[model samples]
Target: MTLTTALALGQTALKLGLICSLTVLALFLSYSMLNVCDLSTDGCFTLGAAVGAAVAICGHPFLSIFAAMLAGACSGFVTAFLQTKLGVESLLAGIIVNTGLYSINIAVMGGSSLLNMNKTTTVFSMMKEALSSTPFAAQTELIIGLIAVICVVAFLVFFLKTRLGLAIRATGNNADMVKSSSINPVFTTIVGLCIANSFTALSGCLLAQSQKSVDINIGQGMVTIALASLLIGGTVMGRGGILKRAVGMVLGAVIFRLVYTIALRFNMPAFMLKLVSSIIVVLAISGPYLKSQWPQIRRRLTHKKGGI
Candidate 1:
């Protein structure tokens, strides 16, 4: 590719990667920090998109962002209630909430599965207009995504260090110990999950505005993608502080989107794209394990050759 073509491709990947990285960071906070594997990510994400799109279409573009986040917080609250109060398993609670969010999302979209914002004023359009006269006008999406990611990473770095944050981390580490210390694990779990889901919803809101549309399946398979990205991030930045690990997650998301962009450039079929995502997930999950086993495998091969 020409230099210009390469630059454009990289920019597109960066834009998408930064946006999707929000979801990956949510996973970082929930799964890695809180030790809660939230499976309602897909529905929460879609719910955010649905709500954001509807609100933006109603001529309140900025309000849509907050509204979507509030919706996500509500979803997280429900999931946490099921797990903490109703004695439901975390995974099952997430699944139940996710299943219910489907109907709720539809209702938010006015009983439609698709929402077209072709003429609607979105946050992106507002940004585009504001940046129209600047030299950086063409980088509107990148700017917005970068700002959001930086804000989130900064928040996490600070949040993870506070007393409450430390307590939440401790709760994740040992609930019984936390209970003994008079820290309510249930409260921490609820707060952690609600915050994480809010980030997920923010991601969805940004993505919908950027695309100028919302589809019910916009968040399909998002959990798998985020999980894979988180694993990749952990591998890349193993044993780091909050800021370092957060940056790794963003890099992982960028790398994932880069691969996806390349796949599409190769004229791969749309159906096969899902397979590609699966393959990426598998590799991301297993790559470190295989690396760890390579030496033993090589030693066995050498022994067999020597015996022969």
Candidate 2:
């Protein structure tokens, strides 16, 4: 590729990676910290896009962000309620919420599958206009995404160190123990999921605005993508401080997006992208275990060679 082409590709990947990193961060909170595999992520993401787009189309660009987050928190609350109060299984609760959100998303989009913001003012456009006189005008999306990531990371770092955050973490580690310690596991679960899903919604909201369009299927397979990114981050950072791991999540997202962008550059069919994601997920999930077993496998191979 020419230098210009490479630069464009890198920029595309970085923008997308940063936006999607929010979802990865959400997964880091819900899946890793809470030990809850939330299957509702895809729907919740779409919910955010739909809600954000709807609000923005009504002439409230900035309000759209908060609206999307609030919508996602409601979705999370429903899922958490099912699991904690209704005695539903966490996975099943997520599945139910995801299934329901499809209809709700459609309603939010005025029963349409797509919403176009071609002429609507979005946060990106607002930023672009604000920076038009500066050299950063063309980098509005990047700047916004970077700011969002930094804010979320900082919030996570500080929040995880607070008392409630410690209780949430303990609940994830052992609910029974947390209950014994006088912490309400139910409350912690609800709060944790609400916060995590809000982040997921923010990611989707920014993505929709950046792309200037919202599609019903825009968030399809997002859970897989976020999980893959989270696993990649865990592998990269191993066990470390919250800030370290949080940074790893961003790095993982960028790396994953870079690989994805390269695959597209190779002229891979659009249909094959899902397979690429699946392959990457498998590799990320299994990499640590396979690395740990390498020595044993090598020893067995040497013994077999000697016997032969």
Candidate 3:
């Protein structure tokens, strides 16, 4: 490619990278706090879009975003209640909530499987209008996404520093220890989950507004994607303090997006996307284990060196 064409392509890639990174950051917070393997993300994501689109279509774009957050929070509460009160397994609870939300999402779209918001009053439209005179229209979404990610990262960092936030993290790390200290782990779990789901919903809402449409299956495999992002970030950044870990998660999401974008650019088969995601997750989750094993090899090598 010519030099000018290469620069243009590079810029496009960078923009896409930012979008994906922010999205992953949002998902990382949801996963870490909730301790919920939320299959419901798939349905709730679509639900957010449906709710956002429905309201935006009626001329209230901002309201739609909040409405979507509410919908996601409710779903999280139900799953938590099922797990904590009804003694349901976490996975099963997520499955039940996810299944129910699927229908609810469809209903929100007027019983249709999708709702097109093209030319409708979406969040992006408002943003575009506000910046209409600027040449930044083409890069608006990327800029907004970066800002949102920064806000989310800051919020999460501040939250984890609060007394309640510390308690919640302790509960996730050690339920028995929290219980011995006279704190109810269940409460922390519920609250954490609610927060996580709300974040997920917010992402969905933003995505819908950005795309100006809501499709029933738009959220399919979202949980996996989120997990992939979290793992990628954690592995690369070395999860440390609350702020660092949170930031890492966002970076991981961006990296995940970059990987996907590169794969697509190379025209890799669609079927391999899931496979690649799974591999990334596996590598991320197993990173610590691999690190621990390294010492054994090092010890053996040292012994041989001394003998020689």
Candidate 4:
């Protein structure tokens, strides 16, 4: 590819990577730290996009962000309630909430599956206008994405170190231990999920604005993407401080998007994209385990060869 073409592709990947990394960060908190596989992520993400777009379309661009987050928190609260208060299993609770969110997302979009923001004054448009005269004008989306990711990462680093954060982490590690220490696991789970889902919603909201549209399927398969990204980040960074690991998550997201962009460049059919995601997820999840088993496999092979 020509340098300009490559640059364009890289920019596209970077823009999407930064935005979607927010979801990965959410998963970092929910799955890695809180040890909950929140399947409602896909729906909560769509809920955010729908709410944010609806609010922005009504002339409250900035308010849309908070509105989306609040909606996401409520979704998280419900999922948490089901698991904690209603005696639902975590996976089942997430699934039930996710299924319910489909109708709610449609309602949020006024019964439409699509919402056009072409004429809307979204945050991205606002930022673009503000930087119109500057050399950085073309980088408006990048700037906003970087700002959001940085803010979330900073919040996570600081929040995960607080007493409540410690308790949440403890609950993830061992709920019984946390309960024995008088810390309520239920409360921690709720708090962790609320925060995590808010991040997911923020991700969807930003992506919607950045694209100037919101589609009902905008968040489909997001959980898989986030999980794969999280696994990739963990494998890359192994064990580290929160900040380091968080940065690794961002890097993993960028890497994943870059690969995805490359696939698109190869003229891969749009229908095959999901398969690519699934394959990437499988590789990310199994890569470390396979690596760990290589030595034993080689030893077994050598022993068999000697006997032969």
Candidate 5:
């Protein structure tokens, strides 16, 4: 390729990278807060979009976005309650809630499988009008997504330092320990799930507004995607402070998106997207475990050399 073409492609890749990273960061925060691999993300995402679109269609675009967030929080709350109080398995609870959300999302859309917001005022539309009238609409979405990601990251960073946030983290790390300290682990779980689901819902709402529509299946397998992003970020960023991990998760999300985009560009079958995502996540989750064993292996090799 010519130099100019190469530069253009590079720029495109960078933009795509930014988009993916921000997305992953959002997922990482949600998952970290919930302390569960929330399957509800799949349905809650669609619910957010549907609610946001419906609200926008009714001339309350901003309120619709907020409503979408609230809806998502409720979904998380249900899952948390089921898992904590009803003693349901976290995964099964998430599935049940997800299943129920499918019908609820349809109901929100008045029984339609999809809702278009072509003429509806959306969050991005207002942002475009308020910020700039540029034709590069995707740029507007990027800015908004970035801002949202940054805000969440900052909030989470600060939150983990607070008493409540530490309690939640402690609950996730060791429920018995937290409970033994006279703190209610159940409440922590509920609050964490609520925060996580709220972020996921916000992502869904923004996505719908960005696309100007909502498809019922838009969030299908979203939990996997989010997990992939989190894993990728964690692997690449390495473990340290809470802030580092959170930032890494976001970076991982961007990396996952870039890999997917590249696969698509190579004419890879769409069906393989999820397969690739799964492989990436598996590798990422295994990285830390493998690293931990490296020192032992190195010591063994050193002893063998000395014996030789």
Candidate 6:
């Protein structure tokens, strides 16, 4: 490929990675820290995109962001309520919410499966317009994405250090222990899920705006991607402080997107992309276990060689 082609591809991947990294960060908080396997992520992401798109189409660009987040918060609240109040398992609760969100998302999009915003004034467009005369005009999307990621990461670092945040983490670690300490595990779980889902929604919202379109399937399999990215980040970062781990998540997202972009460049069939994501997830999840077993495998191989 020519240098310009490579640069364009890289820029596209970077922009996508930054935006999608928000979902990875959400998974970092929900799955990694809070120990909740929120399966509702896919639906919540679509919900965000739909809500954000609709609001922006109505000429409320900035309001779309908060509206999307609010919709996500509602989704989170329902999921938490099912798990905590209705005695539903966390995983089952997420599934239930996700299943129900399909209709809701479609309804939000005025019963349509797709919404085009080619002419809508999205937050990205607003930023682009504001930066039209500046050197960063062409870099508007990247700038917004970077700022959002940095803000989210910084917030996570600082938030995780606060008393409530510690409570949430402790709840994730041990609900019984937290209960004995007079902390409300239920409350913490609710708050954690709420915040995590909000991030997921923000990710979807940003992605939709960046793409200038929203489709019902836009968030399909998003949970899988985010989980893979989160696990990859955990593996790469191993054990680290919140800040380091958060940065690892961002890096993992970028790496995954880069790999995906390269795969597309190779003219890989679109149908196989899902398999690629699945393989990446399996590798990311199993890599550590395989490493730990390698020494044992080596010893076995040596014993067989000696016998032979």
Model 6 lDDT on a 0 to 1 scale = 0.92
Error of 2 at 32 (Å): 0.9
> Candidate 6 lDDT, tens digit per residue, 1-308?
99999999899889988999999999888898899999999999999999999999999999999999999989999999999999998899999999999999999999999999999999899999999999999988899999999999999999999999999999999877997998887899899999999999999999999999999999998998887778777777878899999999998888888888988999987667568778888887788789999989999999999942
Candidate 2 clashes between residue pairs 3 or more apart in a chain or in different chains: none
- Name the better of 2 and 5 by TM-score: 2
Which candidate has the highest lDDT of all?
A: 4
Clashing pairs in 5: 20-254, 21-254, 25-250
The local lDDT score (0 to 100) that residue 13 gets in candidate 2 is 89
> What are the per-residue Cα lDDT tens digits for candidate 5 across 69-140?
788889889999999999999889989999999999999999999888888877788888877656665467
lDDT score of model 4? Answer: 0.93
Q: Which stretches of candidate 2 lie above 4 Å from their native place?
A: 291-308
Regions of model 4 farther than 4 Å from truth: 291-308
lDDT of 2 by residue, 26-122 (tens): 9989998999999999999999999999999999999999999999999999999999999999999999999999999999999999999999999
TM-score per prediction, in order, is 0.92, 0.94, 0.87, 0.95, 0.86, 0.94
lDDT of 3 by residue, 102-172 (tens): 88888888989978888897767878888889998777777777776777778888988898888877876
Q: How many collisions between residues are there in candidate 1?
A: 0
Clash pairs detected, candidate 3: 21-254
The lDDT of model 3 is 0.75
What's every prediction's RMSD, in angstroms?
A: 2.3, 1.9, 3.6, 1.7, 3.8, 1.9
lDDT values for all models: 0.90, 0.93, 0.75, 0.93, 0.77, 0.92
lDDT of 4 at 152: 97
Ranking by lDDT: 4, 2, 6, 1, 5, 3
lDDT of 4 by residue, 1-308 (tens): 99999999999889999999999999999898999999999999999999999999999999999999999999999999999999999999999999999999999999999999999999899999999999999999999999999999999999999999999999898877987898988999999999999999999999999999999999999999888777777778889899999999998888878888988899987677567778888987788789999989999999999942
Score candidate 2 by TM-score against the native.
Answer: 0.94
Give the TM-score comparing model 4 with the true structure, all chains together: 0.95
lDDT at position 66, candidate 2? 97
Clashes of each: 0, 0, 1, 0, 3, 0
Task: List ranges where model 6 is wrong by over 4 Å.
Answer: 293-308
Candidate 4 or 1, higher lDDT:
4
